[model samples]
Target chain A: MNPTSLAPSELAYVPFVSVDNMMKNVSAIGVETVMKGIADYIEEDFLRWESFDKKPRIPAHAPQGVIELMPTSDGKTFGFKYVNGHPDNIKDGRQTVTGFGVLSDLSTGYPLLFTEMTILTALRTAANSALAAKYLAPKSSKTMAIIGNGAQSDFQCLAFKTMLGITEIRAYDIDPDASVRLARNLATSGLNVTICKTAEDAIEGAQIITTVTADKKCATILTDNMVGPGVHINAVGGDCPGKTELHKDILLRSDIFVEFPDQTHIEGEFQQLPRDHPVTELWQVYAGQAAGRTSEHQITLFDSVGFAIEDFSALRYVRDMLPKTGYFEKLDLLADPDDPRDLFGMVLRAEAGRNGEAA
Target chain B: MNPTSLAPSELAYVPFVSVDNMMKNVSAIGVETVMKGIADYIEEDFLRWESFDKKPRIPAHAPQGVIELMPTSDGKTFGFKYVNGHPDNIKDGRQTVTGFGVLSDLSTGYPLLFTEMTILTALRTAANSALAAKYLAPKSSKTMAIIGNGAQSDFQCLAFKTMLGITEIRAYDIDPDASVRLARNLATSGLNVTICKTAEDAIEGAQIITTVTADKKCATILTDNMVGPGVHINAVGGDCPGKTELHKDILLRSDIFVEFPDQTHIEGEFQQLPRDHPVTELWQVYAGQAAGRTSEHQITLFDSVGFAIEDFSALRYVRDMLPKTGYFEKLDLLADPDDPRDLFGMVLRAEAGRNGEAA
Candidate 1:
C-alpha cells in the first residue's frame, strides 16, 4: 500500500473565500442591509426553534487551543460550524478565531453547499447580538458602548447600525491600538465611532452595552458600577468555560436573555451563575410566549456566546447571496451520477473512460 | 442577512470535479496507492492520539435517520466531518452515508482547506480497513470475502487489492444486484472478482472477510458456524450502536482489534462484547508495542467504526494534493487582510476604493 506522504501530489481542488471577498461583498451590500437581513433570518429561525435538533457545541481542548463543532438541523436544512479559538494565534500572525462550515439537505442527505465561515461567523455573531438587542433593548435606544475592539467589535457596530438604526458606537479595549483600529474601520461605515479611554467611558450613558473582549481569564471588562438602568448588555466574549467578562454582580441585577438555555448555561455568562439561574430563553420572546424588555427603565442582558442555528441562517444567506453577487465558486464535492449506486462503477468507468478518451 | 436558497445557476461556477476526474487521479496513481497513503496519515496521527482534542460524535437522531458531526484537532490542524446515516436514504435516491470536512491551522485559527469527504470517506474507510488488516492479517493473505456490497463495496475491494496484495475478492450481498454491482465495478481494478450466492460461500477459505452493509439493524452477516481458524474479519457495517455484523460467538472466538476503544466500544463490534472486552488498540500494534496476529492460525477481527483521524488524514491529503492536481479554485471565504484585527476595514475600504476608482 502506498503511503499518502509518499504521494503528496494527488490533491483535490476546493474553492475558497478570502477575507477580501467577504469585505467586498459586505461593503457592496452595505453593512446596514446585511445586518438587517441576517437579523431577520435569525429571528425567523428562532421562531421555529422546536423544529431544530440542537446540541451544545462539542469541543476538543488541547494545550494550545480549543476546536469545536457546532451543528443544528431543522429536518429541512442542516448546518454546522468548525471553529477554533486559539488566544495565542495572534502572536503567530493569525487571527485567534477562524472557521468554515457545510450545509446539507435532509431529504437527500447530500451537502448542498460549502463555505468559508470565518467572516460569516463574525457577521452572524454580530447579527445575532443585534437581533437580541432588537428584542431586549429599549425601542428608542440608539447609543451603544462596545467593549472589546478585536475581530468582532466592528461587526457588532455594523449589525447594530443596520438592525436597530444605531448611529453612535463608543469603543474600548485594553489595547489602545484596537480601539483606534475600530474607530478607523468605522470611519467609512458612516457610524459615529468614539474612542473611549476606559470601559466605564464606553458604557456610560449608553442604552446598549456590548462586551466582546477575548481573554482566557475572568477579566472584568464591565462592573455593576459602570452599568446604568434600562441598559441592554450584549455580553459576547465570555464564551468558553473559564473566560468571562461581566462582574457577576451585574448579571444578578439584569433580566438576562439567552438563545438556548442549555447552551448558555454552559458557555454564556450564565456559566458563572448557578445551574438554576433565572435566565430567559430569547426564542420565547421572539415567539411572543415571553416578554422581552418589559419597560424602558428595565435592564436586559443578552449573553451572546454564538449559536449553531444563527450559523444556519448565515450560511443559508451566504449560499443564497453568492449567486446574486457572483462571488463564490462551487466545489466538486458530492458525487453525481446517473446511478448513485454505481459509485465504484463510476470510478472504474472513469479510469477506463479516461483511458479510452485518451486513446 | 438574506437566507441562502441556491439554485443550480447559483452554483454552476463553483469548482467541480466530475467522477471522471477522481477516477483519473486514482487510476493514474492507483487506488491501492491512495489507501496506503491515507493509512500512513491515520497511523502517524494515532501514535500522537493524546495530542488531539477528541470528542465522541454529536448525533442528531431523526425518526428516519441520523445526522452527525465527528470533530478532532491537534493543536495545529482542526478537522471535523458532517455526516449522516440513513439506511433508507438509497430508497429516497440518496446514499446512506455522506460527509465533508475542513482542515484549518490552529495558530491563526484559519480554515486553510475544505473538501468533499463523501468519496474521500469511502476511500478512507476502505483504507482504514486495509490498514487494520495489514496489522492483523497474515502477510500471505491473498483473498478477501466482502459480504454486503452496497455503495462502499467497491472501495473495500480496491483497498484490499492495494494494501494487502489481495488478488481475489469473493463478494456477497442479500440483494444480488448489489453483489453483481460490486463485482462489475471491480472488474477492471486488477483484482479478480467472484460473485457468491451466500455469505458462507463468499467467506469459504478466504483469509479476509469484510462486511460493508448499510442496514441499521444488528443482522448477522457472519455467524459462528461459518468461522475458520486463522482468518481475519474486517467488520465495517456494524458501526452504530445496536448494529452488529459478526455474531457474538464469532467475536468471542476472535482476537478483536479496534482504532479507539472508547468509540469502538459503543459503535463497533466491540459493543457485542463485555464493557471490558480487552481489545488491543491497533496503534499499539503499529507502534510495535503490542503483538499483531500473534500466530499464523489466530482468528483476528478488526472491528472498525470509522474514526475522525482517518478523515483528518484524507482531508489533509486532498488539501495538499488539489493544488498540484490543478483541480482547485480559490474560494473567498476567509477575511484575510494586511492586518487581521482590522477586519471591518477590509469590506469598507474595498467598497470605497472601488467606488473612488470607478469615479
Candidate 2:
C-alpha cells in the first residue's frame, strides 16, 4: 500500500521506534555518541527549565508495582512517558523497568512520534547522571565507583567517559555475576574497568560514587565515612517512596541538587530529609542562577529521581534524528475521516467496500 | 516472523486497533449492535460504580484547545484515555475531538491493549447518552429531536432508535449541510429522518430533545420557553469549561441526572446552576438507590460530561471482542531481551550479527 496515494486526511501516521529498531538506531550511531547527544539535549532543556510546565508524575500504585505517566510541555511541543517499575518482574523473566513515550504537537494534540523508551530511558538516566557530574563532580575526576552494576551501570560508565572524560570505572554489585557482566560489556570500549568485591572497595579511591541498587527499600549503600570530601554522589536507584540508598547523615553533610525539588523530595534520596531542607534546583545550577560546586571541599549530591523533562528531552532528540536514521515505522494510530464530522459515514463506507471486495 | 519462536521474554506484543480496523470492526458487528453492547458494559460498570476509583480528569488547557488524561481503576484492571478537544479544529478540516486509550494490567503495569478512540469515543458517547435516556426518557417514546447534526448526530439517532425503539428522528443543524449529511447517512437505516430548518421545527411533538452543538461557549440550544413537561433532554455537546447547551432556567426546572456530580457541575449544563443545587447520581438511579423520572410532568435531564469509567468500559468491551473477531494487529511496543539486565549486550550482539551478515 502506497501511503502517499491516500488523502492527507487518511494519512494519519505516527512514527514508531520498536526495540529492534531502537537497537539498530543505537548501533548506527555508536552508543557513546548517542549518550553524548542525549546529554547535550538534557543540558539544553535544563538550561531553559522555567519554560517547561513541570508537575509530579501521576502514579497508579498497585500491589506489586506502579505505572506512571510523566508529562511536560514547552508551549510548542508536548511529551509524556508511560513507564512501569515492577521490581518483581525480573523473577518472572521481565525487565524491572519498561517504558514508551509519545511526542506530540501541542497545537493539534496529535502524536508525532511513538518510541520504545526502555533503551532510551537507560541512556537518558545515565546521561542525566553524567550531566550533573560535569557541574558538581570534583574537577579532573578520573576514577568512579558504581555500587550496583546492573542494567544501568554500563550506560553510566560510558556516559561519564564520553561526557565527563572519566576514564576508569570501579564497579561492584551484590550479585558478582552482574559486575562481571558489566565489565565484559565494556571490554571492547576504551575505558578501563575494574570489578570490585565490595562497595567499600569500589569507592576506595573514587571521586564520583554512583549507587543504583534495585531493591525497593531504604538500604544504606553509602555512609558518611564512605563518602569523603569533594566527592560527587549520583544517587540513581532510590527513586520511589520508601526507597533511599544513602544514609541521612551523608545527605546532611552534602549540598543537594535536584531536577525538581518537589518531586525529588518524594521519590529521591531527599525523601529521607525534611521537606524544608535546602536543595538547589539543577536547572538553576545549569542556568548559572545558583551555584553547583562552591568550593573544592564541598561535597555535592545529585538526588536523581528522574523527571518528566528529561524524558521530553530524550523524545525530542529521537524525533530530530528519525529523518536521518530512518529507524522508525509509521503507525496508523489516529482516526481521520475525509469529512471530520462524517465519522459514521467513514465506517459505513468501509463496510460497503469490504462487502464489495468479498463479493 | 513467527512471534511464538521468540522466548516468552521477547513475546511482548500489544494488540492495536487502527482507524481502518476500527471501522471494519464497527461494520462487522453493525453500529447499533456495537452501541448496544457498549451500553450494556456501561450499565454493568455503573451498577458497581463505587468499586471503581473516580477522579476528575487531569487537564492541560492551552490557547488552542485542551488535552486531558482520564484514568480509572477497578482494583484488578486499570484504564486511561488520552483525549483532546479543540473546537476550532473543524475549521481546518480536522476533528473537533480526537482520542486514544490504553488498558493495562495493574499487577504488572504492562499495557494489554492500545486502540484509536476517536471513533470509539463517538460510539461510547452516543451509547452513554442512550443508556441514560432509557432510565430518564418518557416511556415508549417514539421520536427524538436532535438539535446538532455534527459528527455525533448519526450515532445518537441510531443509538436512541436501537435502545429505546425510537424509529423517527427530527434532526436540525445550524449548518443545513450537516443536517442533510446526517439525513443522507440514515436513509437506508430504516429510520424516518427529517431535516428541520430550525430547532423549534425539530422538537415539534418530540418526546426527547438532544442538543449536541460543538461551539465551545455557553450558548443555549434550549431555552426555558422551548422545553415542555415530560420532555427528557439528552444534553450531549457542552462538555468543557465555559460550554453548555441549556439555559440556567431549563436546568432549574428539570430534575438533573449526572454521571459524576463533581465533573458535571463544572463541565455539564449544571455549570450554569449553583453548586448547592440538587442532582441525582445516574449510577444510583441505575442501582435502584435514587429515583429517575418519578413523574410524567417532571422534566428529566441527563447532564453528561463523559466520565473515565465509561471509556474504561468501552475499552474493556473492545478487548473482550478482539480474540473472537481477529480485528487487531500485534504491535511490538515493549522491549524484551533474553536477559533483561543485559540490554546493552543485546544491542551490541545485534550490531555484531549485522556486521557478520554483511560480511
Candidate 3:
C-alpha cells in the first residue's frame, strides 16, 4: 500500500495495538488499573450481551497443538482473534500461547485495528475469571487458591487484588520452581503469597479456587471432595475437547454458569457432563434477568471457555493507549495504490525495491 | 516486545512482510514474473493437496459484504488469510478487497511471518485461474475472454498472458468505465486488449472464457450457448452460496473440476447442482491420480472458489522474498522480556519511554 496517500483517501487507519503497546499501557496505568478497567468493560459488554452475535470459536486441532479463530460482532463492529496453544513450545524456551486479532467496522467491513493478543489474552482471561468470580464467589471472600501457575498466574493475581480486594494468594504448580517464581513475582504485589505443594493444599481454607492447569489430558485439578459447598470454581485452561481441569463429580456438585453453552458443551469442564445438563448462561446473569448464587452457601462454578468479546474489549483498550507508547510499528497491511485498479503496477514497483531494479 | 532483542529469542521473528514490501517485490519482479512464480507454486502445492489440513474458509457475512478467514496447514507450517470482499467499496473510491495473512511453524506453533495479502491475493488468484486454464484448456489455446473488468481484471488478464501465452484478452463489464480502466492498466502489459460491447462479443473466438463478475447476486456472465466446444471455463466470481457467475446449462455441458469438494459444493457454481454432483478434484488430476480433459473436444470447467492453500503458497513465497527487501518495518507481535516469567514487569519498563524518557 502507498502508506503516504492512504490518509487522504477513504481508507480507515487501523491503529495497531501490539503486545508491547499493551504492556506499556499496562505499566503506565499500573497492572491493577488495567485489570479493573478490563473487568469493567467486560462487565459492561456482558450486561448488553443480547446485542452481540456470538458463536463458539472455530478451532483447528493439529498434531502438536491447536489453532483457533474467535469472532463476534455487536451490530456496528466486528472482531476476531487468532490464537495458538502448544504446551511443548515451552520446552523450546518459547511461550506456550501466542495470539493476535483484528477489529473491523461492520458497515464497511474494513479492519480498523490490529493488535497482538498474547499478553492481551492473558489479561482478558484473568479479567474474565475475576469478573465471573465477582458474581459467583462468596461475598466476603478474602483468600483465593490458584492451582497451576504457568504463564497466567500473574494476571489472575492482579485481577483478584484489583476487583475482589484479595490480600492473600495460595499458588500450586506441578513444577515446584514455577510456584517459587509465582511467589517471587507477587512478593512486591502487596499481597501475601503462599507456595502450596498440591491442589488440595492450595484450596484448603480458601474462599475461591481458580484452576489454570495446561495439559492436553483431562486432569483433575479439583476433585469433588476437595471443593467446599460455598466456594466458587473459576475454571480456565481446560478449553479444548480432550483437555479439562475439573473432575465430573466436582462439576455435578456445583450450580454451573457458562460463557456460551454451545462452546462450553464442547470445551469447558462441562464436556464430561451429559447433553441434558442444566446450566445458566453468564450473559443472562449479567443482564440481571437470571439469578446468580441465590444464597452465599450455594456452590457456583464458571465454565469459562473464553469468548471473542473479551478479545474485542482488550483490542479496544489497547488501541486507546497505543499512541502514548511507541511499542508498536506499522506494517503496510493494505495495498494503497494511486489508483486501486493499478494494483498490479504498484506490486511491480515494490518488487523493484526488493530485487535491485525492475527488469 | 523489544523489537531488537526479539530475533535472538527462541521464538521465531514473524517479521511482517508489509504491503509496501509485497507490492515492491511484485513490481520489481514485474507482474508477469510474479504471476509465473506464483503459478508454479500453486501447481506444485495443489499436486500434494491431500497433505494439507483443509477447511472451507470461515466467512462472516454482513448485509453489505463479507469478511473471511482462509486457513490451511501442511502439518509443518500453518497459514491463514484475512480478506474482505465489499463490492461497493470501489464506489466509495476504494479497492473492493483488502487482506493480510500469516505463516506459522506448526512445531512450536510460532507465527513465522506476517504479510500483506491484499495484493498478494489478487496475484495468487489470477495465477491460480491461469494455472487451472493450462490443464483444462486445449494445449494450443491462446485468446481468453474476461467478462468482468473491475479491480481483479488487470491481474487476470496479465497472468494469462504470462502463464498461458494468451496473446489476446476480450473484456466487458456492465460499467464501460471499469473496462476502460482495466484496458488502461494493461496497456503496457503486452496482451492484445479488446473492449467488447457485450459478454457474447467478448467470449466469441476465445478458447478459454473467464467470468469474474463481482455482484453478490446470482448473475450469469456466461450462457450455455455462449460457451463452445473445447472451451475451458474459468469460473472466478460465483464464490459464495447465493452468488454465481455461470449459467446452470453451461455447467451441465462441461467436465467439472474443483479445488476442494467440501468447499466448492457450498460456494462454487456447483451449489446450483445436486449434492452428489460428480466433479473431479483438481489435485488428483495434477497428481495423475485422476483424469483431466478426456478428449480434445470435451468442454472443461474449473470452478475456482479460492482455496486456503493458494494463500499459503503466496505467503510462503513472500516470506522468502521479504529479507531480500529492506523496506519492511518490524512489528512487535510477540513479547520478549529479559525474564519470560516477568511479563508484568516488561510493561512497567516499556512505559519508561514515556515523557521523552528512554524505554
Candidate 4:
C-alpha cells in the first residue's frame, strides 16, 4: 500500500534565489537593464490595476520596530513580501529594512518562487519612483537633488538615469559620510555627482527632488520654499505612522499622487492632511483615466510609500529572468508522496531508508 | 568603506529545515515522543494565551481552494505560517494541505528559522487534537474511532496513543484504500488496529470519536443518532467556512470547547450555530478559569478549528530540537553588508568579485 516505495521526488523541490545569486543575476544582466525591466513591468501592471485583489499590508508592531506581510493576487498569480522596519538596527550593523518574498500559483496554491528581496525591493522602489517621474516630471529635466543619502540613494539615482535619462545628481545627508559613500558607490556610473552641504544646497538648481531620510519620527526634509514650480518630488522615507518628510505646507501646494489611497492616508504624506484630501491614484494616471501633469509650472508630488503591486511586479520580473540566468537553487521545501493519502507511509519509508532497508 | 568587505557573513545566513531534514529529525526523536513533546509546548503556550497577539488568518480564496497566512507574536518573538487548502490537489498527486513557516526575533526583526511545515503541520494539528482530548475526553478511554482515514489519520491516531495512552484504533473512510494505508503505516506501532466497513461499526465501542473528513462543502458524516452520551467528539476536519462534518443536532446537545471563538465561529462546527452561541474557550479551561468534563452524562465536543498559536508553538519546538538533532541547512536569505547602510556598496562589491577584482 506504500505508493512512494522509495525516496523523495522532484515535486518536493522549490526554486530559491539567494543573495549571492541575486547579485550574480544583476551582474549577468546589467543593473540598469534590470531596473528598466522592472519599471516596465510595474507600469504594465499599473495599467490594469483593476484586475488585482488588493489590501493593506498586515503589520505586527513592536516598541522597537515592525514586521509586516503584504499580500495581493491577480486571479492567476498571487504574491506576498515579508518585510521589517527597524530604524535603530543601524548601530548594530543591521539593515533598517530587510525583506524576502514569494510568488505562487493561484490555481494550486503552490509556491513557484522564493527570493531574497532586500536588493530587489531597492530596485523596484527606485523604478517605481522613476516611473512616476516619467509621468509628472518636466520634459527637459536633467538634474536630480537627492536629500538624505542612504542605502537606497545609489539605486534611485541609477534608476532615474536608466528610466528618465537624468544626467546629474546633487546629494546631501545630515551625516557627510553617507553622501561620501553614495558618491563612492556611483563613481563609475557615468553621472555627474556633487556633494552638497545642506538640503537647500542640494535642491539649488535641480528639477527633481528625492527625500529618503531614515528617521522614524516626523522631520521636515523639504519645506514649502524648497519645492519650486514644475519640479517633481519623490518622497520615499515617510512610510509609517508618525513618519513624514515633507512639511504640510509643501503638500498643500503640490498636486499629490499615490499608489493606494486607503494605505497612503495612514502611512504616506497624506497622513498630515484630512481624510478627504484629494490625491490621485497612480494606476489611474498610468491607465490614462486621470491627468498626470496638466501644466508646465505645476508642483507634482509622488508621495511614494511603496506598495504590494510593485513587489508583485518585481517577483514577476525575477521569475521571468531565471531561465536566462540559471541563478537559482532547488530547495526541498514540500513533502510529496506518490499517493498523497499515504503521508505516514512516506515517513515510514524514510525511516526504512535510514535503517539501510530497501522496502 | 565596505562593511562586509570579502564575502557573506553569519548574519546573512538563516537556518532552513528541509523536508528531508524534518523526516530525519522525526526519526531521530521517535514519532510518538515527538508528538508528546509538541503536545507539551501546545499546552504551555495555551496557559499563557493572553500574553500573545492573535488575529484571524488572512486568506486569499480561489475557485479551486485557498491560501492563507497565519501570523502571531508574543512581544519578544514573532512567527507566521503560510498554508493552503486544495481538496482537489490529491487528484494531481499533491497533498490536500501544504504549509511552511518562519520564526523571527522581534527586537531586530531578523528571521531565525525557516522550516517545511507540511509534515510539521500534521504533527502540530494532531498534537493539538490530542491535547484537547486530554481535557475533554472521559478519563477511562482506551479506543478511538477516526472516521476519515486520510493524510492526517495516522498522526492523529499515534498522537492519541502517545498523549492519552489509547491502545485501540477503529478506523473508517469512504475510500477503503485509505483505511488500509493507515493500517499498514501503523503496523509496527504497538497499538491494535481495525478497519471498519461502516461509520456506525467504527464507533460501536469507542470512547472518543474523531471526524476528519476532507470535503470543501458541507456534509454530515455523523448524525444525531450516531452520537452517544459521555462521548468526547474531536471534530478535526470541519476547519473552514462552509465545510463541516457533524450534524447541527449533535452540537446543540454537547458542551462545545473551542480554541479561538472568533475563528471557530467562522470555520469550526460553531458555524452551524448562532453567532452569539455559548462555547467554552479551551485556553480558559487549561488556565483553570473554566471547566472541562463536568458530568458522566454530558457529551463534550472539541470544535478544532486550529489557530496561529499552535503553529507558533510547533515552530518553537522545532527550533529547540534543531540544536540537538543538527539536521538543518544554512541558506543565504538576507543581504548583510559590513556597514548596514551600504547595501548598494555590497552589491557593487559582488560585481567586483564577479569580475575577478579584489573588493
Candidate 5:
C-alpha cells in the first residue's frame, strides 16, 4: 500500500523573469535590439497568423479601470497576458497600464515562463506600432511625430528609429513636462528630438504620427485637417470602449488596418466607424495576401489596440533569450508529485519533512 | 527637464506563495481545517454571489488538453486562477490538473497576492463539494462512496469527514494500486475506510456518492439503476464538453443543482440534456431564494463543474491567511517607476545599475 517516493522538485520549477531581471535583460541586450528581436518574432507569428487560436480579451470592467486576460495559442504553445488599465493610477504613482504574463507548453500544459509584462508590454506595443509603420508608411519616411509623451512615448520613438531609420522625433503632450522627460530620455538614443507645443506642430513634415494619449474618454488628438496625405497614423490609446484619440473624420478618410477586427471593432479607433466598414487585417499585409499602401497620396491608419499575439510573441522572445541571458530565477510554481496520482503522499512527505521525519 | 526620481522598488513586489509554502501552510493549518476554512469562505461568497462579476471560464482547447483562466471580481477585488487539465499528463509523472492564482486590488489595479493553486484547488474543490452536500444530502448521511481514488480522493475523504461528520468511506478505482495508495494516505485519519472492487459495491449502502473519475470521454461511471433514492450524487469529474460521468437517464431522474448554469450547460453533465432543461443555481440555494433538498427520498445532484467564484473565494482565503502564516515570498512582478510618465527613465536607471553607476 505504500508507494515508493521519488524526487520531483525539478519538475516543480518554472522560470520566472522579474522586473529587475527584465530590465537587466533589456539593458544588457539594448532596448532597441530587444524590441527589434520581439518585432521579428511578432512578424514571424503574424506570417503564420492562421495557425493561432485568437480571441478577444476577456475583461472585468469597473469604475476606476479594467482588468483583462488576453490569451492566444499557436497549437503548440499557449500564452496569456494579465493586464490592467487604470488611467487614474498615476495619481498614486502607478503606471496607467501594468501587467504580467505566462507562456506554457501545449503538449504538457506546463508553464515555461512567468514574467513581468509592464516593461515588455511597453516595448512590444512600440515594436508592433513600428512594424505596422514599416508596411504602411511611405518608404522614404523618416520623421515621426509622437503625440503622447507619456510612459509609452519613448519606446515608440526608439522603436521607430531602430526599425524604420527614423531620424527626427517630434514630441507633444498635454502636460509639457512629459515632452521634456521624453526628450531627455531619448537624448542618447541618437534621434534628433524636438519638443512641440501643439499636436499640429509635432506633425509638421512628419510622415508617421503616433497618437498614444491616455484618457478614458473620446478626445481628438488628431483631426481631419491635421492629418495630410501619405501619413501613417499609429493610434495606440483608443484601446477601450468610449475611449479614442483620432477624430472620426480622420478614420473615415484613412485606409484602416487592425490586428483583430473582432477586438479592434470594440476597442480601437475603428470603434467609431460602422461595423461593416471596410478594413484590412495587418497580418494579411505581413503574409503578402493583401496590399498595403497602394498609392502615395492615400492615408493609412494602424489602429494599434495591441493584440494577444503580440504579447505571445514577446513572451516567446523572452523565453528563448533566457538561456543566453540567464536573467530569470526558477520558481516552484507547480506541484510535481513523483506519481501524479499520489498528490496526497507529497503533502504527507512535506509534513514529514516539517516534523524532521524525512531525511 | 529631468523629472525627480522617487523610490518605487517597494511597490514592485507582490506576495507569492509557492508550492512548497502551500504544502507547509496546509500541513501547519491541518488539511481538514484548511478545507473547512475554504468551505466557510465559499459559503460566504455564495451567499452574496449577486455582487460578483461572474463569467464562464475562458478556455483554450487543444488536442492534448485544455488551459483555462477563471476570473471574477467583487468590484473591489479581482481574482483569477490559471488551470490546465491534461489527462495524459499523469503518464509523464505530471498531474492531470495544475493551477496558480492571483488576487488583485481592483481599486488600484495592483495584484495583492500570487499563489500556487494546485493544492489550494484540491482543497477548495473538496470543500465546495462537501458544502453542496451539506445543503443537498440527507441530514443523517454519514458514509460517502468515492469511485475515483486519484489525486483528489484523499482531500475529498478528509473534507467530508471534517465538514459533514462522515465517518466511513468506500473507495474504488479502476486501478487497484490507486485504491491502495488512497487507503494508506488516510490511514492516520480516524475515519473507517473500505476498499471496494467495483463501483456498484462502493455505493452499496452509502447515502452520498461522489464520482470524480478523470476521463476525457462520455463515461458511464454510474448507471440509473445503481443509484437509489435519497442519495446525493456529487459529480465532479466530467467538466469539459463531450465529457459526462453519469448516464443521461440518471440525470433526468435527479434534481440538478449547478454553479453558473451558463457554464454548466456546456461543461457539466447538463450538456447531455436539452438547452431548456430545468436546473437550480447553487448560489440561489445559499441565498435562500431556491430549494436544495425538499424530501428524504428526493435525489439531488450537485453538478460541480467548478466556477470562478469558488476560486475567488479560495484566493481570498489564502490572501487573508498569508500574514498569520508568513508562508509567502515577495516577487518583483510589476514595474514601478519613480514618475509614472518616466517608465523609460526607469529602464535607464536599471541600465545605470547594471553598469555599476546607479548607487
Candidate 6:
C-alpha cells in the first residue's frame, strides 16, 4: 500500500475562496451586481421556505463575546457558518464579526466549498436588508438613514441604490471617523451621501432607517420619537441576547417582520417585545401569503437577525460563480482512500511513501 | 485603507493541518504513541467533565447520509468538529466518515487551529475505547476480539496494545477482505493477530470484545449467547438513531457506562434499553465517584458513542503538538482590517492593490 499508488477522486478537493480571492471576486463581478444576485437568490429561497431546515444559530457565550454555528439544509445541499461577534475585537485589530462557511453535498455529505465569509456576510446582510425594504418599505422611497456607519454601512447604501433605486443616504455614527470612512467609500457609489452629526439628524425626513450599531448591550440607537410614519426600520445591529438597538415603544407600534421568529425572539430587536407578540414571517410577505406595509400610516420594521438560509444562498451563488470568476483555490480538505474501508491502510501507505522519499 | 498599508497581528494566521500533513504527523509521532497521548488527554478531560459544556451533535439528515456539528467549550477555549456519516459513501470511493475541526480562543472567538480530523478522529475514537477499557475491563486482559475490521479496526488494535497492554487480537468482519486488510496493516506491529472466519470464533478466549460493524440498522452483532461473564464490550458503530449492534438481552445483563446519557440514549446501544435504565457516567467512574468493574463476574459495557469533549481534547492535543511536529500550514482564514469596523474598506483596498500591481 503505497501513498503514491492511492488516488482520490475530484470530490477530495474543495474550492476555497480566501479574503484576497473574495476581494477580487467582488471587484470582478462588481459589488452591486453580486449583492443583487445574492438578493435574488434569497428571494427565491424565501418563497419556498418550507423546503429549508431552519434553526436558530447555536451560540457559545463567554465573558467577552459569542461564537455561533448557523446550519441549514435544503434536502440537496447542507450549509453552515462559523461566526463570532466580539465588539471589543477592534481594540485588538480584529473584525467585530468574523466568519467562515462550508457548503456540502447532501447525497455524499462531502463539502463542496470552503470560504471566508467576513466580506460575504457584509454583502449578504446588506442584500437581505434591501430585499426586506423592497417588500416592507413605502413605494417610491428614495432616501435611507444609516445610523451606524461602520463596515456594513457602505454595503447597505449600495444595496439599497442597486436593489430598490434609493439614491440618497443620510449616514451618522457615534464615532465621527466611521461616518467619514463610510462617506469616503461611497463617494463613487452613485449615491448622494450626507454625513450627519447625529442619528436624529440622519433620520430626519428619511423613509427608511437602518441601524447597525456594534455595542453588545441593549442601547437604543433609535427612539420612538425619531421614527416617523411609513418608515421601514431595518434593525441589523441588535443581534444577540441583551443586545437591542430600538426602544421597545417602537416595536410596540410597528408591524414587525422577521426571518425566523424563534431566533428573532431571542437575538433580534424583537427580543425587547413580549414572547407571544404578533409578528409576521418575512417569507410569507415575500411569497405574497402575508401583508407587508399594508397601510400608509403603518410603521414597518424588519428585525433582521441574519439567518442560515441567507448564508446558504450566498454560498450557492459563490459556488456557481466560481467557474466564471476563477477566484478560488482547491483545498485537500477531505481524506480519500482508494478503498473507502481501507483508511488505515491509506495512512500506512502514506507513511511508507514518506520513508521512501526520505531514503 | 490600502491593503499594503494594513497590518494584521500575529493572530491572523491559523495553523491548518491538511490530510497530507496529518499523515506525516502520524508517521512522525508514531501511531501508537499518538494514540496513547490522545488517550491520556481524554482521561484528563474526563476527570473534570463538569467543566465542559456538552451537547448532542447537531445533525442534518438527508435521505442518503447525515452531516453534524459537535461543539464543546471549557470557558477558555472552544472546539468543534464538522463530521459526516455516510455508510454508502464507500460506493463512491469515500470513507464512511470524514471530518474537520476548529479550535478557537474563547476570549476573542478567533480560530487558532484548523485541522483535518479524518485521521485524528480515527485515533481519538480508538483512544477513547482503550481509555474506557482501562477502567472497566478485567485486570490482566491481553487479548481483544474486534468484530468489524474495516477502517477503525487497525487503530483499535494499536490503541489497545499501546494503552491497555493488549498483545493479541482476533479480528472478524462480515466482509472477510476487511479482516484481511486489518491483519495485513498490523502485520509488522509487535502484536500477534489472528483472522477469524466468524464472530463466534473471534470471541473465543478473548477477555474483551469490540463491535464496530457499519450497518445503518439495528442488526445484532452480539447476542446473549455470545457473551461470557466478566468480559468488557466496547460498542462503537451504532452511533445514530435506529442503529444498534447488541441484542436487548445482552444490554439487560451488562453494567453500562456512557460518556453522556442524553446522547447515548438516542444514539448508542442504550437506545435499546428503557429510558429509566440505570447506567454509570464514565467520568464518575474515572474520577472515583462511582464504581467500575467491582467484581470478576460482572459484565461491563462501555457504550461508546463519541462525544464533543473527546474531540475537544483531541484538538487541544494536536494544537499543543503542532510546534513540535511542525506538520501544518498557516491559513489566511480571517480577514483582519487595520480598523476592525472597516471590513469593506479592506476588500476595497485589496482591489486597489491588485490594480496597482497590474499597472
Writing each residue's lDDT as its tens digit, candidate 6 over B1-359 gives 35457444566678899888888888899999999999999999999998999877889999899999999999889999999999999987888899999999988989989999998999999999999999999999999999998888899999999888999999999888888888889989988989998999999999999999999999989989999999999999889999999999998999999999999999999999887999999999999999999999999999999999999999999999989989999887888877788887887787788787777
Off by over 4 Å in 6: A1-8, B1-9
TM-score attained by chain A of model 3: 0.91
The DockQ of each candidate is 0.38, 0.71, 0.55, 0.84, 0.80, 0.82
Q: For residues A70-137, could you state the per-residue lDDT of candidate 6 as single tens digits?
A: 99999999999999988888897887889999999988989999999999999999999999999999
Question: Model 1: per-residue lDDT, tens digit, A1-359?
Answer: 12222121112223334455556667667676777788788888989989998878877666678778788888777788778787886664556776777777665566666666777888888989888888889887789999889889988998888788888898889899999888887787779988988888887678889899889888888878878788889999999888889989999999999888888887878988898988889899999999998887788999988889999998778767666676655455555443556666656655555566567
Q: Which stretches of candidate 1 lie over 4 Å from their true place?
A: A1-28, A173-181, A184-190, A295-297, A319-327, A356-359, B1-24, B175-180, B188-190, B288-290, B295-297, B316-329, B356-359
lDDT of 5: 0.91
TM-score per candidate, chains pooled: 0.87, 0.97, 0.92, 0.98, 0.96, 0.98
Q: Which ranges in model 5 have alpha carbons more than 4 Å from their true place?
A: A1-8, A357-359, B1-8, B357-359
lDDT of 5 at A210: 93
TM-score of 1: 0.87
Scored by DockQ, the top model is 4
User: For candidate 1, what is the lDDT?
Assistant: 0.77
Per-residue lDDT tens digits for candidate 5, residues B61-106, read: 7889999999999999999999999999988788889999999998
Model 2 over residues B193-262: C-alpha lDDT tens digits?
Answer: 9889889899998999999999988898988899989999999888998999988899999999999989
Of the pair 1 and 5, which is ahead by TM-score? 5
Native RMSD of candidate 2 (Å): 2.0
CAPRI quality of model 2: medium
- Candidate 5: true interface contacts recovered: 0.79
TM-score (C-alpha) between model 4 and the true structure: 0.98
**Candidate 5 collision pairs:** none
Error of 1 at A210 (Å): 2.6
Better of 1 and 5 by lDDT: 5
